[model samples]
Target chain A: MAKNGNDKSRHIIQFIWTLITNAYLIGFIRGKIYQGKIKNICVPGLNCYSCPGAAASCPIGALQAVIGSYEYKFSFYIAGFFIIIGTLMGRFVCGYLCPFGLFQDILNKIPLKIKINTFRFDRALRYLKYIVLIVFVVIMPLLITDIIGQGFPWFCKIICPAGTLEGGLPLVILNDSLKSAVGLLYGWKCFILILLIVFSVIIYRPFCKYVCPLGAIYSLFNPISVFKYQIDKDKCVECKKCASVCKMGCNPTVNPNSLECIRCGKCKSVCPKDAIECVSFNKRKTN
Target chain B: MKNNKSRIITVSMLLIGVLFLSAGILRGENIIIFEKAINICLECIGIG
Candidate 1:
């Protein structure tokens, strides 16, 4: 009961944060900032840096900036920050903090008439994120150098609907000059955004499930991440109820820390025997 | 019984931790290194 209450409270808080970070609010705040050093808060999860309303710096953008900086070295500060957050909370950030994740959650609530069962295909395609993490997020930027031999934001340009919807749209709208300069790349991004918006209405979080390199990176820590779920085999009867309720279709009993498991706690809430519990690495070590 | 449970949990955590650490290290080495960061920065700033 207490766990469920905590989950509900966390969900509410996440929803409120999403509202505050929406394009309207961020744009308003950014409009107020004329000059001085604006302290940009780095929230975990993908938010767009180019969004006219964004008050905080997108971590991905900052990381890319560091990568693409004139200096020929990676910024330890940004990398360390992401590592610390990922190791500590894993995808809990995705479930409890990401504004984009919250947007998907809201879209998921729209009383949709059509639903597709792509569990098998989805399971296979989940590996695609690791490829994306390597190719788009990590490799492409590093390997592709220009005349002066500097990296580019390949992932941001090619993919990332958050960048398109939150960053690209607002900037183009607010600055009429940018509208006139719109090209094939802008159209491509808009197309991707539309596809994602429509897909989100049908699927839970197609991006999070298949495309989010950030999610892929965080998922690497899912097993050993401080915030984790455990299943007591002694109490479990192999009822498969947990699996049935899992939106990610992950079997908690087989692998409680499956990369696909978002640590949403839905399975834990539904378990009859209270076999599942959210455990901390520190707590386990001390015991 | 308690010892057995503890051992299982410890072993599980160790294996998982090693897997994650290895992957992180591999990714850091193979993909995200200093040279790459420099390249990305240059491209974004349009000097590339």
Candidate 2:
């Protein structure tokens, strides 16, 4: 199938945004991280704070840090960032802004063994991200504290393939000291990252579909986000073209605002009758 | 009526976000983010 122009544009935007957000070139060269005022601001996607070129904090990482900190139990800044961004675009951030999403997109483009459009237990597995959000991102950071009452970023330490791929590998590769310090945890994370990379080649966005806590958080706002999918029932012919084209397994005609829908516009692009449109919540009635 | 309700909800959420953000800034939470982000996160890099 020919690539849609809009899809092409989205890929460009994703690439450009990834570069813009991770624009600290000096850090990559010197094997050091960017320590600047911009670091105080959290990025909208899953870019790692430990990424040498990253100039902004990751929302998940910052959230975990604040929740884990003995001195501070909650962070209004992080909460507010999530609310504002989620309400504005929901998983649109996953579609267009996330660096790891871009990575998966690129990896999926590689011609590999037969692609599995949907795997066994796909329906049930989608709920795993929510579990990860509650347990790893929220509970672990809040409940499990050290002797000094400091909590650890359990998700980052334990399950975040983005952290492993973006922060762990690059820093370890660049720093000899880090290479020597690598242990079982690093190996475990690397194994998880490799598994995800392999799965992403076959199943599109396996992490976002089943593992990303951030995606789970943003998805809660999909039904109410200002920007959302709207189908023209009048123009629709009940063709399942949109569903077939949807990598996220959403039926745009039936439930355009499914939490699984990333607002990636693949469904819109492939709709033959021009029935699909991404409309704001306020303008929904007019359409 | 539904549209009005949605608009109200959206506006309310935005206001709440603004309020939370203002409170966070007032409490110097951004400084904490800055401090944490400035350092090398050993756990994040799998070195912790």
Candidate 3:
């Protein structure tokens, strides 16, 4: 089935609901007022597990725990969860879900609207996210050790605005007695969050483009993702409209599976050539 | 085409390696970093 603009908008709205509810912001508020147990739904994105209001575990955090566990060689649960989600829908998770991605989308809606038309630089910079995935997510925690011998989730500490927004702020507000303990790390996180918010207004999805390790992981499955886009060469006429409307800043013609393409389907909706279609796994041929 | 294909293959290999390696590293120990550090550090400072 073809996607319309309204369908895209609905997806965005649903994404917002998922974010607010899944972040346990709602539960946090409820739990705070009623003294009820905080309930959290473990969604696939990088929502922080430590958010005081959080009812569910962050998938990335869960994965990290499984990895760092001494008794178990690795966490089958976290790995299986990511693999299942990834293999099933791939980066459709980024396009259809992901609160952080939605937040960036909202920020990118600011009407000043100066487009930074730097295609080559954008493509080159997309690789930086992979570097983040490697260095912060993988290497630091495994390699670096303090004198007491504790591993760090370097990515969560150094990056991740979701934690700041969801975990940091709520906890601060709730626990007034805990207010005086501010330090450089909080300042740094606030600085990064502010930077991301400001950049999101100017450049679309600055985090998704440059820093999101989760997006980087999902992008790997783009080539074989079940929810994929197919372009018809026979229908010819490369007007570049698809590329232009793409919020993810990808050329659907050249690299339909681009890590930058969130599969948001703006291109598919606007294609004058009627060239693009969403491909399902069950269907063998592109219609 | 060959160079492009090779580059993609290399990138894919590297990504898979990194994912496994990351999963390995993050299994059990929950050392706070990034935003978690901010939250914890804030809590430590009596802010959060």
Candidate 4:
């Protein structure tokens, strides 16, 4: 009963954080993107830069811009930002802070008969996000250039369902000028967004599992992050309860700091022995 | 010993992050990020 309460609290926290991050009320009302100094700082989640209500920039978008720009090949600021955040909490950002992750969590709550938690090639498909981080977010931007030596943010342009949903839809719907400009590309992105929405209802965070470049980057630091999970094997009875409750499909009994763990705390809540705990920076109990 | 190593890694990574962030700020990378973010990129909205 206490664990279930914690789960409810997690959702409430997710919703509250989402509201705090995208809190430019004037922008939402006027269909304009916030151009404040706050926008200079990139939020840890996958919120879009062009979102009418977004008061902060998306880190992935900022990373691509720096890598793709003619004047700057790379930005130390952005790199440092990722390192600091990734090393501190890792994919806990995905679990608690991401708007898109919240969207998926909400969708997965709907009662569905055919919930596809995992299927064949599920583990293999997890690598696709890293490939996207490399190819679309990193390599393509540096390699391909326009006449003026400017490069495109390929992921934002061709992919990034978050951009399409959070930024594209609102702006286009509110502004008639943007409506006429919308063409086949917009249609394609909308289709992808729709497909993802449907999939989210059936599957648990399919995008985070298979396509989110930000999730990919953070997942790399799950093992070494200052905030991490610790499982006490002495207390554990080797029951598979923790594994079964994990929506991200991580087995905390075998590996407490699995790369796939979003630090959602489901395993911690469900552990019968009270063995799993989220601890900070090498604070393991002596037992 | 494992705990000690983890502490070292965390501190080292944090110092490195601070170093890089300082360097980027000195290079005016924040200005570039600000400029890019203030304007709505056509591509970001899935158009143009």
Candidate 5:
């Protein structure tokens, strides 16, 4: 009973953070972006800084913007923020903070049966996010410049569904003059966002699992982060229940902090001995 | 040795993160962070 209760509360916490991060509700209604000093800081999740409702900027997008512009030096602030958060908590941001992850969780809760990905295929696709992190967010932004020495923010322009959903869709819908600005690129991004939404309904966080460069970066810190998944071997009964409940397909008994493990704590309740936990300095963290 | 190595790396990362985080505020130009933050960046809005 306590386990189910804890899960409910965890869901509530994640939902609350989602609301907090996207809390500029009036931004959507007014169709204007939030322009405040708070916008300078990067939120730890995949929330788009340009989202009409966003109270803060995105680190990855900020990094790309710095890299693409000839006027500014490379971003220490953006990179540092990511590294700081990544080293402290790893992908806990994905589990508890990401609005898109919440979106996926809500979609997965629909009546249709969920699809579990095959291990081989899942492993193969996991590398794609890293490639995207390097190619779109890093290389393309720095290398491909126009006459003014400004390169494109490839990921935001070409692939990031978050930007399209949070920033583009609402702005275009609300503003009349912006409609004339719409072109083929907007159509391409809309198509991509639609596909990702459809997949989220069937698959467990397809974007976080296979396409999010931010997740790719954070996963690097999972093994080294102060807050981490710790297994108490003495308490283990060797039951596979933890693995069974994992939507991201991580085997908790083997590697609890797998790259794809969003640290959602679904596996913790399934552990009969309470062998699995996310802990720091020997103290368990309440999600 | 492995544990020591990871601790070393962790400490190093923390130090660097602190440096980088502060660098923007102290030594860097505002154009880098604000240019993106202040504007309704076209790319971020899914526009070309």
Candidate 6:
């Protein structure tokens, strides 16, 4: 699996966009969040709404908030917004736009060569994210609520390493009051985040593959999203070179459009036969 | 036959997505999202 020639500059766009979306690093200097109109609209990633550097709302947290609000039901607006993102881009957002995914990519780049690529193990674990999406994100919030019609956002409060990383660490470290008040739950989330950070270095995008409710949701639209990662079977020589470069361990030759694929195009970049390419919407690609 | 059926289904799904987006705009989802986002979510960050 020779590296792609463009790999040198391939991630620059992701890097730049990651920084730009999180560009409110100025707030970190002042120890206050950006309170503005832009925070109302959702950004299509796992960025924490509480991150002082954040300019927009997190879709997952917003979804949970709407559900746990006095309404205690699905927000047609949130559902509709997500459906639009899902149909338009699918996990391409995970591939290119998500700060959390970029964080995983950066951690994986930290010279730790441990790879967890046993076929069945990887495939089996992908289902866990779907379970998280259904049970933690959807079911629990709707089913359980306090007297005031507020329910805990189970995934964001308990499981989201993104929140623990982007929002929790920053808020606690910056604010003396918050730091002094850290409790068992904070410690617990810190433990989960540390474990995830370590695993992200060893295993590619373990959270996205195994636990992210957003990833689970986006995956449902991958097969039908406007953007497509297509393989021309006519040109594919069955060399399986594409899988070698795939962080998600997909055989892009056989399953270029697999649900687990983030559509990162690392495989497309590495394809020796020029077999793989991303075909956009509005045209039928027979791959 | 298969491709046509798939196209029809995907088109319908996309149309529904459009409807959802419209509903979001009409219902002022931005206001709801803004309120949740502007506040420092103590519980979300694992605080009480």
Best by TM-score: 4
After TM-score superposition, what is the CA distance of residue A30 in candidate 4 from its true location, in Å? 0.6
What share of the reference contacts survives in each candidate? 0.02, 0.83, 0.04, 0.81, 0.63, 0.63
Q: DockQ for every model, please.
A: 0.08, 0.82, 0.09, 0.82, 0.57, 0.64
Pairs that clash in candidate 5: none
TM-scores for all candidates: the values are 0.78, 0.97, 0.77, 0.98, 0.93, 0.93
Q: How many clashes would you count in candidate 4?
A: 0
When summed lDDT is taken over every stretch of 10 residues in candidate 3 chain A, the lowest stretch is A32-41
**Which residue segments of model 2 deviate by more than 4 Å?**
A1-3, A284-287
Q: A12-123, model 1: which lDDT tens digit per residue?
A: 9787776655434645443321111232335577866455554455666666655654453354545555666776788887888787887777777678799653656878
Q: Which has the better DockQ: candidate 1, or candidate 2?
A: 2
Judged by DockQ cut-offs, the docking class of candidate 3 is: incorrect
Model 2: per-residue lDDT, tens digit, A124-210? 999999999999998999999999999999999999988888889989999999999999999999999999999999999999999
**Weakest lDDT window of 10 consecutive positions for candidate 5 chain A:** A278-287
- Total clashing residue pairs per candidate? 11, 0, 30, 0, 0, 0
Residue A188's lDDT in candidate 5 = 92
Q: Which ten residues in a row have the lowest lDDT in candidate 2 chain A?
A: A278-287
- Docking level for model 5: medium
- Model 4 segments beyond 4 Å from truth? A284-287
Per-model interface RMSD values are 8.7, 1.1, 8.6, 1.0, 2.6, 1.9
Candidate 3 ranges beyond 4 A from true positions:
A1-13, A16-27, A30-41, A117-120, A146-149, B1-48
lDDT of 4 by residue, A192-266 (tens): 999999999999999999999999999988999999988787889999988998889999988998989998888
The sequence of per-residue lDDT tens digits that candidate 3 reaches over residues A213-234 is 8888888767765567777887
lDDT of 4 at A277: 80
Candidate 4 iRMSD, 1 decimal: 1.0
Return the lDDT, model 3, position A241.
88
In the range A99-124, model 5's lDDT, one tens digit per residue, is: 87788778776767656555568878
